[model samples]
Target: MADFVDREAIRHCLARLARGEDRRDAGLIRAAWWPDATFDYGVYSGDFAAYLDWVVPGAEAISNTQHVLGQSYIELAGDSAKAETHVISYHRVDMGAGDRDTCIGGRYLDTMARRDGEWRIADRVMLYDWYQDWGAAIDWAEGVMGYPFTAGHFPGRARGDFSATFFAAGQ
Candidate 1:
C-alpha cells in the first residue's frame, strides 16, 4: 500500500538520524535532513547546521546517546509525507570519572519530502513530553564525575573573577 511506502521512507530517515547520532557521525546525521531543516530541542532552537555545529563539538564530551523510536503515524500524499515519531533518548555523559544517565522522551512531528527517490526531512518540530528527574543529590554530572578543581586561581591576585571550578563531577 501507499501508506506502507511512506512509512518506510520516513522510518528510514529517522533511523539514519538515530544511528548517526548514536555513533557520533555528524555527516550521516546531516544527510537525514534537508539543507534547511529547522530543529527545536526545547532550550536550543536552530537549523540543522546550527544543531550540528553545537552537537558535533560535544561528541568527545558526550559518551553515549541512544534513541528509541516508538510507533509512528504517517500520512502520504504523492511525493510528500507527514509523520509523527515518538522517541525516547537515553544519554550518558562522562564527567571524567565515569558515565551517568541523562534521558529524554519526546515526539517529533516531521514533514518529509521525496527528492530523487530519497526521503528527507523538510520541516520538523520536536515536542518534549518529559525528562528525567535530576535532584539535589550531587546533580546529574557531579554524580558521575569525580574531581574537585577550580579555575582562576592567582597566587598574588585578589579573588579573581573565575573560581569555583570543578572537573570530574561526582559528589
Candidate 2:
C-alpha cells in the first residue's frame, strides 16, 4: 500500500472516460469502469453501462460538448483509492427553430480499485453544484456541426420526430 496509488493512472482513467463520452463510443466508455461499477446520478442509479446508455446518446444528439476536468482529490489505501474531479461542461442542443446552449459545473466522486495492475472506477457519484442554462446563446452553435435546427433558414428545419432510442443490445 502506497500513499499515492500512481496518480497518473487515475488521470488516465478520467481521460479515457472523457474521450469515450465525447466520441460516443460505448466500448471505450466501458473500458473506463470496472465490471461491477455502480453509478449514482441525481436521478439515475445502476451499473456504469446503464448510465452510459442513457447519457451518451443524448450527448451525441447535441451539437457541441466539452467536458473539462479541473482540480482533483485522490487518496489511496491498499489496492483501492478515492478520487474527486471538478468539471465544467458546455453543451448545445437543437431547439427546432434555433438552438440552446448550457454550461454546467460539477464534481465527480469516484472509488478506484487496481486489479492486476489496471485501475478502474468501481463507483462514481456526480455532485453538481449548479448549472447556468444560456438558452439559444449561439446563432449557429458557434460551429457547423449539422445542428438539427437552422436548415436553410431560421424557420426551415429537418422534419425528424424525436424519440428515446437506447442501444439495449449493448452494440
Candidate 3:
C-alpha cells in the first residue's frame, strides 16, 4: 500500500511537471522541484531554477507544444525514489513560409524525495532516445473550415490563454 501511494505521488509530480511545460505555467513547473534540485539535459546541466529560466522562454517562443507521456518505472525506498519516465514531445515553429514540426523521444530519470510529506524532484537527467524534424504538411490553423484552431477559441497553454482563465475560474 505504501509503495502504491508513493508511486502515485511520484507519478502525479511528473504529470504536473509535464503539464507545466505544455501550458507554460512557471509556477507549476517550479512546484515539481526542490529549491536546490539539479538537472541535466545534455544541452544544459545546472540548478533546477536555472533550468526553468532557460526552458520556459524557449518553450514560449514556439507556436505550440505538446508533451505525450508514456510509461514510468519507479523504485521507492522510504521517503526517496528513483524513476525513469518515457516521453514524446512535439513542438510547432512558424517560419513564415510554413510551420516546422519537431518530435523528440526521450526519458527523464529522476531522483525524488519527500519533504514535509510532499514529493518533489531532487535531481533529473533527461536522456534523448531519438529526434526528428520536418515541415508540416497541413496547417491546422488553416483547416477546411477556415478557422484558426489556436486563435482564442480553444484554451491555450500560455499565459492569458483560455486555460488560465478557465483554471482561475475553478471550473
**lDDT tens digits, residues 117-165, model 2?**
8888999999998798788644543335555454433321222212112
Residue pairs in clash, model 1: 142-169, 142-170, 145-168, 145-169, 145-170, 146-168
Candidate 3 local lDDT, 1-171, one digit each (tens): 888888999999999998888766789898999989999999989998798887676643476778888999999988899999999998887666567888899999999999999999999999999999866735544643665655644534422457666678985
> Each candidate's lDDT (Cα)?
0.73, 0.75, 0.83
User: Which portions of model 2 show Cα errors greater than 4 Å?
Assistant: 1-5, 59-61, 95-97, 137-171
On lDDT, the candidate that comes out on top is 3
| Clash count, predicted structure 3 | 0
Candidates 1 and 3 compared: the better one by lDDT is: 3
Which residue runs of candidate 3 sit more than 4 Å off their true CA positions? 59-61, 94-98, 137-140, 144-151, 155-161, 169-171
**Each prediction's RMSD to truth:** 12.4, 8.3, 2.9
Residue 14 of model 1 has an lDDT of 94
What's model 3's lDDT at 33? 94
Strongest candidate by TM-score: 3
